[model samples]
Target: MHDTGHNDVSPELDRRLMAAGLRLGRRNLGQTHPNPAVGALVVRHDSDGPIVVGRGWTAPGGRPHAETMALEQAGDAARGATIYTTLEPCAHDGKTPPCTDALIAAGPERVVMAIDDPDPRVSGKGRAALEAAGIVVTDGVLAKEAARDHAGHFSLVQKGRPHVTLKLAVSADGMIGRREGERMMITSKPALTAVQAMRSTSDAVVIGIGTVLIDDPRLTVRLPGLAGLSPLRVVLDPSGRLPLDSRLVTTADKVPVMAVVGPAAPANAKAALIESGVQVVETSDGPNGLNLHEALAALGEAGMTRVLVEGGARVAASLLSEDLLDEIVLFRAPVVVGPDGVRALEGYALSAIERSPRYRQIDAAIVGDDLMRRYWRD
Candidate 1:
C-alpha cells in the first residue's frame, strides 16, 4: 500500500481502506468496459475505531459511479467523514454529474484515492476540485494494484484501442492441437469453465477464419446464469472464407457478431454476411492480411474496451507480430502432443533473444490438472 503524503490517516487504516476498495471494485470486472469499475467507502471515526458509514461499487454497465452511490447512502453522515475510493472521482459529466461536486456537497473532511483516472477529461481535475473546496485529498494509495485492475479501460483511454488479451490452451509440449485431421481436447473441464468466465467479462471474443471453419465455436458464455452475458463474437476473415450458414452467423440475432474483412473480399460475401445480421467491417490490407491495427481502432470507436483473442495460430502470430497484444493467458495441460501437432503461434521470428517481446509473469495457478499462467507486457 503506497501512501500519499497528505492525510493523517494511520498507515494501517489506509491499507484496510484500500483493500476494501479493491475488493469492491473487482466485483464488477468484465461488467464495466470503457468505464473503469470503481469502489468507494465512507468511514467515520469514534472512540472504538473507524466504522464504515456507507460503501458502494460501480454498478454493471458503468452508470451511477461508486462515489455517487456511496455519498447517496451516507446522506448527512458524509459530512466530515473520510472517503476511500479505488480510483479518482470523476469531474466530467459524461453519463452522470461530476462526482467531485457530490463529494464536495457531502462535505467529506478527507478523500483518499488509489489511482488517478487516465481519461484526460478528469485526470487531475477531480482532485483539484476537491482540494479547492478545502477538503484534504490523498492519492496513490495501492495505486499499482488499482491500475492493474482497470488496465482495459485505461488502455482504451490512452491508446484509442481495446486492451487485447491472447488466450491459449496448449499441451505440455506447446501444441495447441493434434495432428492435422485429429480432434483435439487439450484442456480439462476446469480450464474450459475458466474460458467461459473470461468470455463472460470481455467486450468481444476474436478469432481467425481458420478457427471458425475448423472449430465452429459458438464463442458464447455458457456458464449457467452467465449465458446471457456472452460477449460480441468477432471473426477475422480477410478473404470472406466464413460460411453463411455457420452458427455465428445464424445466431447473430441473439448475440452480435462482427466479420472483419479486407477491401478485396468478395462483395457478394459481404452482402451475405450483412443479410445474416453480422456487422461487416472492411479494412485496409496489410502484407500478411487485413490491417489488425485498423480493425482494433474500429472496435475502439465502437466502444469496445477489452478483447479476448482465442486463436488458431495465424491470428495469434499476427497480433503478436504487430505488438498489439497486452496480456496473455496460457492454460497448459499435462498431456504432451508431438511435433506434428499444430503450434500455438506461427510466423513470428526474432534474430536475437533480446529483440523478442518480454512479459512479466503476473500469476500462476492450477485448475484441475491444468496450469493457468497470466502475463502482461513488460
Candidate 2:
C-alpha cells in the first residue's frame, strides 16, 4: 500500500519476476524464522517459453535454506536453469550444509541475487564458491525490498543477536511526562497490539532501570488468546537498583534475570530480589553505565540469540554508540514531543558516525492517533 515505486521499473515485470521468485521462497519457512527469509526460483526456457521449473525458500528449524530448498525442488530440471533468489546463496556450512554446495549440485547456468549477505561467515563466501564452481552469478536485483523483508535475519547472521530498536511515544515538543507527573499514552491501541505481536516473535524483551521505574510495564504479550505467550523479561540495572516494591520483582514467577554492572549484588538487596525469584547476575561495565556489549555477551551465554530492546533514550543511545544495536522499531504517534523531553538517540559525535545505519521499513500504518513503523537493520 505504501509507495514502493522509488525505483524505475515496470510493475508488471516486477510482479511476475517476484512471483516466480516467491514461489521458490516458501520452502524454507519453517527453518528460517529467526533467520533472513530466503526464496529461490529456477527458470528454464522451453517450447512454451520461460517457465519456472522449481522453487524453494527457508523452512522452519533453521535448515535447508532457500538455495538448498530450491535445488531439492528443481532436482534434474535445475541443470541449465537460472536461479533468482532473495539472498546470495550461503557459502559457509551452518545448520545443515552450505547453500553454495546445493547450487553447484543443481548446476544452474546463472544466478540472479537480490542482496548480498553481510554476515561475516557468508559475506562473500557464497558468491565466491559459486564463481569458483563455474556458475554465473549476477548481484543486486530488487535488493532494497528484499533486505527490508529479511532485515532481522541478516542482522542476526552478521552480529549474532537480533537488532535492538527502541520505540517510545511522547507528547508535543518532547515531554514524556506530563504536568501531573503522568506518563502520556502516545501510541494508539492498534500500535500497541502490533508491538505485542513483535514481543511474541522475539526470543527476549529487554528494558532499562529508567523504564522500569517510570512505567512498571509488565512487558508481556497480551493480545487476544495470547495472554501468557510472553517473551523473557531482561533488566539492565548496573547497581541492582530496582526497587523492592517493583512489579517485576513481585509478579514474575518465571525467575526473571537481572543484569547488574559490578561484583556481587549487595547482600540484603540480592537476598530480597532472589527471594522474590529474580536471578541476579553481576557483570563489569565497558565504560558505559552497564557495559552493554558485555551484557549482550552474557545474554549469548544464556542462550539468547535474539533480543528486542525497549527503553528510554540513554539505553538506546548507548547501544547505538557501541554498535550493539541490530535493528530499530519506531512508533511515530500524532503527538510530537518538544525539546524538554529526551531525544531518540543522544551523545554521539556526528562526524564520527559511519556505517550509515540502514533499515528496511516493515510496517507503516495509522492506529488511532499513532503511526507505527517497524524497521530492521541492513
Clashing pairs in 1: none
Please give, for residues 1-378, the per-residue lDDT of candidate 2 as tens digits: 222123233344444666567545543322244566677888785655567777777765456676676677778999988777888777876676787888898887777777788878888788888878887777667777676556556555655555455655544443334433546676678777877877765656888888888888788777988655566678888667778677777766853555454543466776777787777766765554566766776665554555678776667778877767656666666676554545555454321222254545556666667655555454
Over 4 Å off, model 1: 1-6, 348-357
For model 2, the local distance difference test gives 0.65
lDDT of the candidates, in the order given: 0.86, 0.65
**TM-score of candidate 1 against the unseen true structure:** 0.94
lDDT tens digits, residue span 257-315, model 1: 99999977999999989988999998999945699999999999888888999987888
Please give the lDDT score at residue 97 for candidate 2: 78
TM-score of 2: 0.69
Q: Per-residue lDDT for 125 in model 2?
A: 83
Q: Residue 213 lDDT in model 1?
A: 89
Model 1 poorest ten-residue lDDT run: 348-357
Residue 166 error for model 1, in Å? Answer: 0.8
